[model samples]
Target: MLQTLHRVTILGPRLSFGSRPFSVSSILRANRAVVYTQTGDPSQVLTTVTYDALPSPAPDTLNIRFLLAPINPADINVVQGVYPAKPSLTSLVEGHEVFVGGNEGLAEVVQVGTGVSGLTSGDWVVMTKAQAGTWASSRNVRPQDVLRLPRADGLTEVHGATMTVNPPTAYNMLNDFVTLEKDEWVMQNGANSAVGQAVIQIAASRGLKTLNLVRQRPDLDDLTRKLKALGATKVLTYDDLADRALTKTIVKDWTAGKGIRLGLNCVSGKDTTAMARLLGDDAYLVSYGAMSKEPLSLPTSLFIFKNLTTAGFWQSRWYKTHTREDKENLMRTLVDLVSQGKLKEPEHEILSIGAEESDEAAGQKIRDIITKMSAGQYGKKVLLRFEGAQ
Candidate 1:
């Protein structure tokens, strides 16, 4: 379960700065952001910076105030200097340069440039791609860098904050890979993951079935019940999949004479081999993540006899190749599922940074959350909320 945070918007005084004294606009909005100058461990490198005033939007930009931002595992990876995509360093911080440390988040258009079109004040939007520096109070960005989202579509701020990554990844993998028909099956490990949960619900919405696999746990029964309710056709522990007879029996019954044609693997090692063995002839296995930190070991028999085609999926690369319109359509579809109650938001915890709090307080809070996340101590996804302004 997730507790909701109450939002507090602090407005600044209106002023006129340009040639025309008649021009009235809000000036000198205070800002706070979590930034890192050099890539290293998050707790060591991340710093909280403050701005007494944010500049108004430029002719081709929009002033976006972040409503919420998620602390994803990939975010920690990028900060630790492991991820491929790197944020640009800036000297705007006065004495030294810094790089903002967030990728996915939801924001509101506080101000739009005179030349901007299709977006206005109060409209909600999200970054179209990664490395947009979302962990802040506000930013001035180009209209094309973000995609507008429908507030009336019925998604909460938490859901919107996370919209750019996990759900979209699951949605694309399901559609981009093997064409699965109604009642057809798709198998995946990390069944309890955010992406896995989204895959289960989306598959159900399309009348597809899923065989979900997870590691054994004390509350396995409860976890199984929960995932089943989320539309998983089968929720099995890794031990269950490891049992040869049990694996054959489950796959035989679920496939109904047609073996699983699509396999999504996040955990590699033996888990990858087990899934590869279950794929039918001409099946496709897509590896999006390596949660196990072990190299994938494929048996020679799978490719020679099963004719399985192995590939990889990365949402960032997909965004780079796809167009803006394509991204919008995907977001609208995913949000509609939430609006219609076909898909459920995952469990999450919110970390609020109040205006009265010092920069060290904010940085310490983020550090604690990231430390727990890295240690796998939290079950709920963690999101950050800034106070003082809408």
Candidate 2:
């Protein structure tokens, strides 16, 4: 009877059945989403899917409305079917079984079920794990699938949407890899990247200084000023990595007899080897990303003589191994830092999508953003806002 009622409501107008005055749930014509069933190029495979009504929360679930989502490189890889973890494709919603494309986002609880606790309507939340299918106007997720945020006050959509992934990744990498004393030094490539920026801010807040290295660009000075403003102790180009004179200068001025205890490498390839060479004795070098898509080349002597250690870090893997309490604790710490104005958010460009926009229009706009990112033309991080909150 319930299934028949659902079908009738989805197919046409609401109908009364017996004593219950039948009506559609919380669904509305404003609900729309972008999904892909068969992965390929996102532009070719992604489709704009809309629903006539939003379903009420299940007994163990919360009804969510997406507020903001980001365009991470990993998200693009997920759409291309190249990511390590894939979303489970099922016909759970509107008989359209497909994988939604976002891995991280900030959402609002529109409704809560009887079984849920510690969360209420109008509360802000974020995905606690990957593959939560956040690239939609609305979703029905279980309590364990999301972590409740402190509050929406004093938090921007960009910060709330982006804080979960990069900030925590940077925070954990700094804390989990090696123990560093206050004022100890750490070196990392991709200094201008989002994670890099977060690393700079978080390290500074902890009284640790970072030796940041980024790719050489025409606007190197401008980039250097920006990073320094974000609390980068020292910024250099990749070209400076191979220069003996530059290394000598860095050692003389920055190290001051103390060794860099931690090394962060994201570019991999020769970049990884370059950063590894700068670590102190018995230090750790954590590789979090391979943005260069190149092979890592490690010198044999560092492992034997310097006793240097190389490790890898992935936030998703960490989430799987840790408890929900552990994650929430870390998130609380990070959020406190942001609230205290000790950490700065990364630069972002907001793309607003009205709730009433046509699916083709929305899909094309997303495609254009992806195209820009693919060509490396996008300078700032791209953020998607469902309404005009940006």
Best by TM-score: 1
Candidate 1: global Cα-lDDT? 0.83
Across 278-368, the per-residue lDDT of candidate 1 in tens digits comes to: 8888899999999999999998888898898999999999899999889989988988998988877778888988776656667788888
Residue ranges of candidate 1 with Cα displaced over 4 Å: 1-29
**Which runs in model 2 stand beyond 4 Å of their true positions?**
1-29, 388-390
The candidate 1 region of ten consecutive residues with least summed lDDT is 14-23
Deviation (Å) of 13 in candidate 1: 36
Cα error, residue 128 of model 2, in Å, equals 0.9
Pick by lDDT: which candidate is best? 1
- Per-residue lDDT of candidate 2, residues 1-390 (tens digit): 221122211121111112223233322235666677677787777655555445677798888888888888888888888889788774444554667778889899999988999899988899987877777778888899899887534677678888789999999999997888898998999989899999999999999989999998889999999999999999878788788667856765778968787999899998678777777789998888898999888999989998988899999999999998998898789888888887776798888776556456777888888977978898798887665211
